[model samples]
Target chain A: MFKVKVYVTLRESVLDPQGKAVTQSLNSLNYQEVTDVRIGKYMELMIEKSDRDLDEVVNEICTKLLANPVIEDYRYEVEECVAQ
Target chain B: MFKVKVYVTLRESVLDPQGKAVTQSLNSLNYQEVTDVRIGKYMELMIEKSDRDLDEVVNEICTKLLANPVIEDYRYEVEECVAQ
Candidate 1:
């Protein structure tokens, strides 16, 4: 089995309200030096079949189902690397 | 500066659509053994202050803003240990 981790976040130029709220709260806690915050989702997936074809499969999953390409960008890493 | 990380996830019993969708995608990727998944939010905060008052402030931030206690739960750790 292989372990996969997926992280999804809005494009850097996009505004994040949830992040902003958290930053403001942090500032109030005397953490005023913090100027920016971005919130994102993390997912861990366990794959049973990883026969050296991880990249292709992970790409297909990310593009077709894991993330919305238009609004968010996703990056994933497998516990072990598979050749192209 | 100090660092604080906040993780928010649906309560264990709550159903997570994002998690389910990812799990299904993984299954199609030949990761059939995967049966469950959970998606969560992570926030990293950089604080300027590293005094003994970190807990009081961190607690205030979590309860007041870091998380919506009703539906989300958050856990945070200070880079440096702080006394109660």
Candidate 2:
């Protein structure tokens, strides 16, 4: 099997209101050192061995369902795993 | 300055209904090779130089705001960066 770790983040040009809210909350709580915050999504997927290429499958999944291509960017790491 | 990347994930024992829903969605979309899915949060924080230890500040922030200690686990990577 293969384990894939995916990270989907907002593009730098986009505004991240949720992240801004969190940063403001932290500052209110006295964590004044924090200058900025960007929030994103992380996902782990377990895929059974198959004839299809792993990279192709993962990329397709990310583009089709895991991330919004217009405003978000995604990257992933794939590793072989022994199924449990 | 410092750039901190934090990943917050559900504990292994916790039920991830969102992940399950995504997995089922993928299956219905014909991505049957996927066996499991888990979803989590990824965040990036830009912190100004401080007298306080970086590790201590990050740990405190994660515990107090970034993660739910009861059901989530968080890990972070910190690196120095030239402020822009």
Worst 10 residues of 1 chain B by lDDT: B75-84
What is the TM-score of chain A, computed separately for every candidate? 0.82, 0.97
* Ten contiguous residues with the weakest lDDT in model 2 chain A: A75-84
- DockQ of candidates 1 onward, in order? 0.36, 0.93
Q: Give the TM-score of each candidate.
A: 0.62, 0.98
lDDT of 2 at B45: 99
Which residue ranges in model 2 land beyond 4 Å of their true spot? none
In candidate 1, what fraction of native interface contacts survive? 0.55
Mind giving the per-residue lDDT tens digits that candidate 1 earns over A1-84?
666777787787878898898778667766665666778777767666635576776677777777778878988877843534
- The per-prediction i-RMS, to one decimal, reads 2.9, 0.5
Please give the TM-score for the first chain of candidate 2: 0.97
Error of 1 at A17 (Å): 1.9
Error of 2 at B80 (Å): 1.1
